[model samples]
Target: MNMSIVKKLKALHQLALSLTCSALLSLPLVAETAWRIDTVASDLDFAWSLAFMPDGRFLVTERTGQLVILNADGSEAKRQAAALPDMFVAAQGGLLDVLLAADFDSSGRLFLSYSCGNLNANSTCLASAQLINDELTAIRPIFRAQPERRGAAHYGGRMVQLPDETLVLTLGDGFDYREQAQNKANHLGKTVRLTVDGAVPADNPFVNQAGIAGEIFTLGHRNVQGIVYDPQTGQLFSHEHGPKGGDELNLLSAGQNYGWPVATYGVDYTGARVSPYQRFVGMQDPLYVWTPSIAPAGMTLYQGALFPEWQGNIFVSALAGKALHRLQLTAGKVTAEQVLLADLATRLRDVRTGPDGAIYLLTDGAKGQLLRLLPN
Candidate 1:
C-alpha cells in the first residue's frame, strides 16, 4: 500500500472509533427515566412531616397523631414513636411535625408540634419525646401556648436547629386570629428559640418580659408553615400561608415585627382588602410575595451533588397549586422561579432533600404518595 494511502486509512479508523465512543456516552441521556409515585409506601392517612434517621430509616408523622418508621426502600413500615398525645385534628389541627434531634444517635430524642384539646378550644403545643424501639417514652410538653384556648386549624409546625444550638419553632396563629400574631405575650404567630430539653434560651426576644414566654425569637407571623436555615449565611427564611392572595416569604429577623393584620399585600377570602399594605411604621417587608398564593407548606434549600445546578435554590411544596415551586436565590433574593410536576397536579404536602442526594416528597390525600425526583 502507498504510504499516503496507509496514513489516510489509519485516520479514518480513529474517526470512526471516536464517533462510536460518543454514541455510547450519549446512550444514558436518551434512556433517562421519569419520576414515579410510590403509592404502596403511602397511605390513606395524612403524612404531614418526615425526617431521616442517621441509619437511613424515615420517621414520618401522620396528621392523626401516629408516628411511623419507614424502611429506606419504602417497605417494612413500623410504628416507632407511639402514644402521641390527643390531637384536635379538626380543620388544621392534629399531629403537625416530627424531627430527629441533631444528636438522635446518642439522645434518642425527637421533637414534635401538635394541637391539643377540642375544635372550639385547641392550642398549639411543642413537645419532645425519647424514642425507644417501639414507643415514645418520657414524652414531655416543653412549651405550651400562653392563655390556651380552643379552636381548630392553623398551626405552623416546622423545626430547625440553629447554629447557636437553639431550636427555632414556627407557630401559626389560630384560624382568623390576626391580632394574636402581633402579640409577643403569646407563642402564636412567632418563631421561638428553645433548648433541646424545652428550656427557654436566655437571649430570647422577650426573656426579660414578665408575662411573655421567653422562647420567642421573632414575632408577627400569620401561619408560617415552612422554615429553613441558610447554611451559607446562618439566617432563617420562612414562608407562611396567606388569606386569599398575599402569601409571603420572609427572611426572619430577631425581634422584628412582620406586619400581618396591620399590613398586607392581599385581602380576605370575601374579597375585602386586608390591613393596609404598610400598617406599622417599623414593620418589615416580605422578601418575596406571592400574589396569587402558592399555599406553600414544606421548604428546604438545596445543597447536594445529584443536581449541582439546583444549589442555593429554594424548594417549596405548594398545596393549592398542586406543584413544587423552585425559586432561584442569589444573596437571599429570589431571582427566578420554576414549577415542577405541573401535569400530575397533586397537592404537594412536604418536600425534603434525602440523605441520598435525591428529592423526596409526600403528597396530600387520603391515599397520598411518597415520590422521588431524579434528573432526567
Candidate 2:
C-alpha cells in the first residue's frame, strides 16, 4: 500500500511484460480415469454452485441471480427465480453459493451468498432463505462484508457447513483492498464463521477481541473459492487463486493468517512481485502450490466407495486450466496429483460428491451444464 512500492512495482511490471515468459502453466492433458462424463442438465446461466435436497431434487445457482430446481435425473423441475437483493451482477459478482440447512427436510431452510449493492459500492452478503412448495421465500440477511468496496471483482462467495452445523463463508479482498486482507477489522479476504441464524459464535478465535471482526475464522486470503471439510481427519482445507501465479492449497485453521499480498508465491498480473517474502514469520504456508495458477474453484473430498482409488482424495475443479485435478493427500499434505476429465475443456465452477457416490460438476457459461462423473 506504499506509493513508492507501487511505483517500483509498476516499473518492474513493465519490464517483465517486455520479456517473454514461458513458465505459465499450460492446461493439463486429459488422462484415462475410472469415470465417464454424463450431461444431466444444460442451458443454465453461469451456474456457480449447487446443493442436493433430501428427496433427491437439487438446487443450482446462476450468477445472474437465479435459483433453479432440478430433479434427481437432472430434469428441469422449476424455473422460478428467487428475489435477488439488487445485487451487482457484473464480471464476477452475483448469486454465488447455495447450501441446504441440516433440517431442510422439515424447516425448508436454506442459505446463499451473493454480491449485494450497485456498481459504485458493493460487498459480499450472506442470506438465509426457505424453499417451500418449490418457491423460494422469506429471504433475510445474515451477514455482509464490512466497508463496502468499489469494484465488482473479487467477491469470493463460497460456503460450507461444518459437522456442528456452523456455516463458514469465504470473502474476497476486493482487488483494490488486498492490503485489508491482513487486517482483522473487516471481512475482506477472510473466512467467517456463523451460526445457522447468522449469529457470530461466541467461541470464534477473534471473538471478544477489540478492533477485529468477531465472525472472522481465518485471515490473509486473496480470493478463496474452493473449501471443504474433511470429516476423516476433522480438518478444513481451502484453495485460493493467486495473481499471475502461486495458486495455493492450504490447511485452514481458526484465526490463523494464511498470508496474501504480504507473503505470496504469486506475482501481480503485471508480473511484478507482490511481496519480498514468499514465506514470512507469523504466517502459515500452503500445503501445495500450483504455479501459473489453475484458477481452482470448486472442490470436494471423494468419500464415495464407487472408486476405491479415489476415495479420500480431493477433487478440485479448475476454470482457466479447464481440467479437474485429483490430489491425494497424507497428513494434510499432497502426496499425488493428476488431471481428470480434461477433454471436457470447459470452465468448471463447482464439484460435489453426491449421496449416490457420484461426482457432480457445474460448468461455467451462459449454457452452463450440470454434469456427472459416473463410474466407468
Best by lDDT: 2
lDDT of 1: 0.75
Q: Roughly what TM-score does model 1 have, to 2 decimal places? A: 0.87
Q: Across residues 1-376, which tens digit of lDDT does each residue of candidate 1 receive?
A: 2322213323433333333321101111112234444443667368888788888887778887778787887775686434656556776777888888877799898888888877666787788888877467888888766656566767888888876566888888776677888887787788887888789866665777887768877777889899887766555778998888778887776677778878877788999877767446778667677768889999988886777788877889999989888877654456667778778888988999888778888888778777878765
Worst 10 residues of 1 by lDDT: 22-31
TM-score of 2: 0.91
RMSD, one per candidate, in order:
15.0, 9.1
Give the backbone clash total of model 1: 6
**For each candidate, what is the lDDT?**
0.75, 0.85
**Model 1 ranges with Cα > 4 A deviation:** 1-40, 278-280
Best-fitting candidate, scored by TM-score: 2
Residue 122 displacement in candidate 2 (angstroms): 0.4
Tens-place lDDT per residue, model 2, 51-157, is 88888987999998888999988889987766867667888999999998888889999999999998888999989989999999999988888889898988889
Sliding window of 10 residues with minimal summed lDDT for model 2: 1-10
Per-model TM against the reference: 0.87, 0.91
Which segments of model 2 are wrong by more than 4 Å?
A: 1-32
